[model samples]
Target: MTFQAETPKDDSARQVGSILAVDCGSVFSRAILVERVEGTYRLVACGEALTQAATGEEVLAGVRRAIQRVAEVTGRALLSERGFPIVPERADGSGVDALVATLSAPPPLRVWLVGLVEEQSLASGMRACQAPYATVCDVLSLVDPAVLDDVGGLTARLQRLRPDVVFLVGGTEEGAEGPIRRGVEALSLAALALSEEARPVLLYGGNSRLRQTVEEIAGPAYRVLAVENVRPSAERERLVPAQNALEGLYLEKASHWDPSLDLLRSWSEHPLQTTARALGHTVRYLGLQAGMDVLAVDLGACTTTVAAQRGQAFTLRSLPGLGMGAWGSGGPKPSPERLALWLPEAIAPEEVLEVAATLGAHPCTMGQVGRELLVEQALARECIARALERAGLRPGLPWDLVVGCGGFLGHLPRPSQAALILLDALQPVGVTVLAVDATFLGPALGAVASVEPLAAAQVLEQDAFLKLGTAVCLEGRGREGDLALRVRVRYENGDTLGVEVRAGTLEVIPLALGERAELELRPGRGFNLGPAHRGRTTRVYADGGVLGVVVDARGRPLSLPAEPGARRQKVQEWHWALGA
Candidate 1:
């Protein structure tokens, strides 16, 4: 297997007919095979198995098992006698042309944040920490209550934490440097207290003027790296610089995360990539290719990532310990009452708590097909909502495409249930196209693009993405049961269906998969589709999937009844409407 750091300018230099990509997640490991069929890249087979890294075994055991399953399905010999992948296919076609991987199973990096102001640079630093798989163990800022102590006190605290990275950020470029310089001194002192081998790496992303002062204070004992200021000015924030630096650190530190990782690295021909960063790459690439604003939400067992791209601007926020796998973990479990708000069935709050506890204890178990499934979906909604809020994305932006990835969203019993979960959580305004990562290969493709851009692009366009259909979500408000939108659906086959959608209700129009239709939407006096289409008639040509065009006239910032009984009824009605 081989990997490249970036796509080469010349695409014709390397030729690969077959590719193998694997993702070693916390709870599950997956493998996929993509091959050229009729001169086009296509997904040939997929296999999944329980991750074996937690059992004191090398991750390769699980990856090999997944590959063995695929080989069984396609009658392809991918692994040799000793479990190592065969490189460069022979005459008999027993090997692949290339191999690549993405990993999310290793322990995240421990980061300590130091900045001048709590609400300014420190807050910006907090968001940047989400770029990599990292946890903020502590923070020291001018406004922090703990900052009242002397340098000695701060040194002792830092000694106890012993974080992997000390991220120092503050002040604007060419702005006040005194406060940030003081911050650097205090943290450098704390870092020097540790032994040479135990000392943490210091990264300064504060005012550029203090770069020399930071190096002088830390001396040679500490490894100091400087990057573009995270806060170039009070009103502007640039996270890519710090995010890139921390991501590099994550790659360096991850090699030691497990005894088997070193072996995995040795077998690889290229550098390992983080799952979150690779997923963000695919999101940005697809958005640019489609020439539209795009948003992607990946719900994993141990993490939930939200990435968005609008024109040339892109943002990614990865929140650890906020996924379905941590639903009832020790950190912060939502109250049953809060979760019950989204449950469609009349389930008691105590029952909800019990199920969440059991699921959290055994996050890898995946046979939920009853009330338990409903509870899990409810938990997914909350997790996605929290990740989006923390992502700091501008609300009410018309997302031309919204893609959902991960097991829970991908393996749902019905497509409408998947669509409904996204709708309830995102509540996106205006018209948007919804799709799912059909083969869980979005990140893998991102890794493969470095070596084979044609294969990655072809598979992504043909077989990797499954469109769940388009959504027409209303943004304005009107009295309940009042007319909100007059919709006319004109199918390509010359069939027409007209419906009057009322406020506070959900409606679905049936259009088969691969079907095409043109919709004419006329909003009522008080309601419109979006900010740009207020009180206007809009026409859109949309494609179909499992669920046709969804007309959500429930208003923006969808409201719910305060009374539990009334809310349950409304929620149940929505489920029935979607046939979920």
Candidate 2:
């Protein structure tokens, strides 16, 4: 099969026919077809299938079947129907205007990690690789004297895996040369062992000492490219170069092994590196075009990725240790001690463990018990906060927007339920606005952005984003009923409105997109919202979006006297006040 790449020009009015996007995630594969109608592309058909039952030839068969099913159900033939043109027949004759497939396969991209110290520089290197779509295949810790002493054994181990690529990361800007030279020495020895054809590509994001050494050593055996060090300083981390390198390696090397690659090769555009790339694209695009920092989290079965964009810099972290899926069988599982730090005392350890294990195993089951649901929310909040911290973004960073993506948050049966899940998961503080990826199309638009940025931006503005207006909450924790949040709106058109809400409440105010409304917040007696955060009146421009207003009641311990029914009553009161 041959791969075709398309460079669609910047013509907003271009009459591109129905185009289908197939995202092969770890748990399931999905197809979405969009048709350009009246100069706007609209989603017309979609389908999904469990991904585990297929691989290799079986994977191709599944795609064929899914595309046909969606076509049949949508009353549009795979090749032809009414105003749409026939998706040009390939030499093999299956139909589609343009088909794009992305994969989030397990045994996720195996990478040979090279770094300075196992604990510090190497640790940061692992974090950098984990940020994109990669798995640490083997870490060659240069600081480990054993690695330097046993070059032959280390070389053998690396050759055995035939890793897709070697990620060479090391050095602090102050003392980079030593570790970088040592890491390159290990890479050179490893390169000598592999056959020319089997020799893995090397991406160096390390110190300057070994630039020429690495290039010369890898020249005859493999492809070597140099980039900026991911951990250039102890205080900051630079991960984009590593992430880009991983995506480059996936397209050039890893795709060849995927069973679905042949089908993807048949499409007219270059294959994408799954939803991760798309999410990265969206974060970057939104950050650049809208002039605001953005954070997007896609919680999937086998892994969860947290991506953030600030200015022109973007960071992505893949938490392989924590996920809503079963593949984390051997890794460190979330413990009671960790859960206890966030959960209320009433939720038993056994119940917390059971819920965590259930989510770890099932990945998709909604919690059946009320208390269990609360525990899950607490876990999600903890996970999100930890991810943000890793990226150097605090929960209260004056972050202009926070968005939730993936099936669990976007496709929930009810909008309120979706909003509540986001509220519980993010536990966002300060005056941040919120939204969810309504179309699950962030990745696709991101890929398109690499080629046609304006088109991608336009599509995102018109179709992908759903605004969930400003969230009003105190910066710190609060007792169960101590702080109340009330919003008063005075429209420019002289309309006056008021709504009283309590902490822990997620209230939805009726507002429409692009429609502007002025908001004023009245914090309870002991609380503040502005300069020292000292101001009494704060005006905000509210845009109708996904999770309207999140009042985090658990700003503090959410304490209630240990009387049996008191805790339940407090929870009920908070829920009632939030209109749950």
> TM-score of each candidate?
0.91, 0.78
Q: How many clashes does each candidate structure show, in the order listed?
A: 0, 12
Best by lDDT: 1
Error (Å) of candidate 1 at residue 33 is 1.7
| 1-580: candidate 2 lDDT, tens digit per residue | 0111233465565444556766766666667666555755556666766655533444444555556667676765664433222455334533555655566654466788877767667877777776456777777667776777677886788768778778887777677476566556666776787677777778888765566777886676568988776777777777777777776676555356565555455554655655776677678767766778777887666667788887767777766554555323454466665555444346677877777777776665666447766666656655655656655666545456878777666655445544544555555555667777765677666655443444455566667666766666554444445656678876647787798755544455665555567788777765555233457657776665543444453442223435545655655554554454
Tens-digit lDDT track of model 1 for 88-176: 77789898988888788776778989887788899899878877688899987754545634767877877788788889898888778
Give the alpha-carbon lDDT of every model.
0.81, 0.62
Clashes of 1: 0
